[model samples]
Target: MRRYPEIGKFTLKVYYEKDPEVRADIQKSIAKYADFKQNVKQLNFDSSQFVPGIDIEMMYNDMYWASEGYIWEKIQDEKYDVDMMERDFLKMVDFWKSIYLRKEGEHDEGN
Candidate 1:
């Protein structure tokens, strides 16, 4: 995670990993971040101040591209099962929301 003051931007970059599981986790995190940012936007919140929306970008190596049995690879295909990805993203978002609510001393009813 990195924040640039000059540009008033936040970004998260994940380096390519040899382990398929790790890569998948990184992808899930990115998805969660995107969902959380969108939810924030929908709430009419100022992301540039309250959240300062993050740009999540991923890097993949040749090894990942060559994989035939990896879940990440399956996710890239249009016909693949996407429930796993959605579940992971939602789970991550829930966990983060819990933490944020705790920090802010707010109830998690609507969140």
Candidate 2:
């Protein structure tokens, strides 16, 4: 079996509505968990790993757009709503973190 590189960084894309308000929410939520600005060095999408019901294409597009500037800039941009975007972003971050943690080491039965 091939070993994947340790997930040193991650980027999350939320594919819900294009509305700025909703996007903001998602961004805020993500910030609460993952430091989108600090933790995520780059944002890209893999269709094979994307969650069901989420539009991976749209998320990828948003990430590409946000990549132009730092996390704060992306959140402040009128293109998306920080609060709503945070929610989805955070969830995605959490999921990614979980996978990263799992791959790093197996949980000890007694810890």
RMSD of each: 15.8, 16.4
Put down candidate 1 lDDT per residue, 21-95, tens digits, no spaces: 778887776564345345445556433322222332111122223332354454345354346655755775565
What are the TM-scores, per candidate, against the unseen true structure?
A: 0.27, 0.25
lDDT of each: 0.41, 0.47
Candidate 1: where are CA atoms >4 Å away? 1-43, 46-80, 103-111
lDDT of 2 at 3: 33
Q: Using alpha carbons, what is the TM-score of model 1?
A: 0.27
lDDT of 1 at 71: 42
Best by lDDT: 2
Window of ten residues with lowest summed lDDT in model 2: 1-10
| lDDT string, candidate 2, 7-55, tens digits | 2111223423357988888777655334434533454434344444445
Model 2 C-alpha lDDT versus the unseen true structure:
0.47
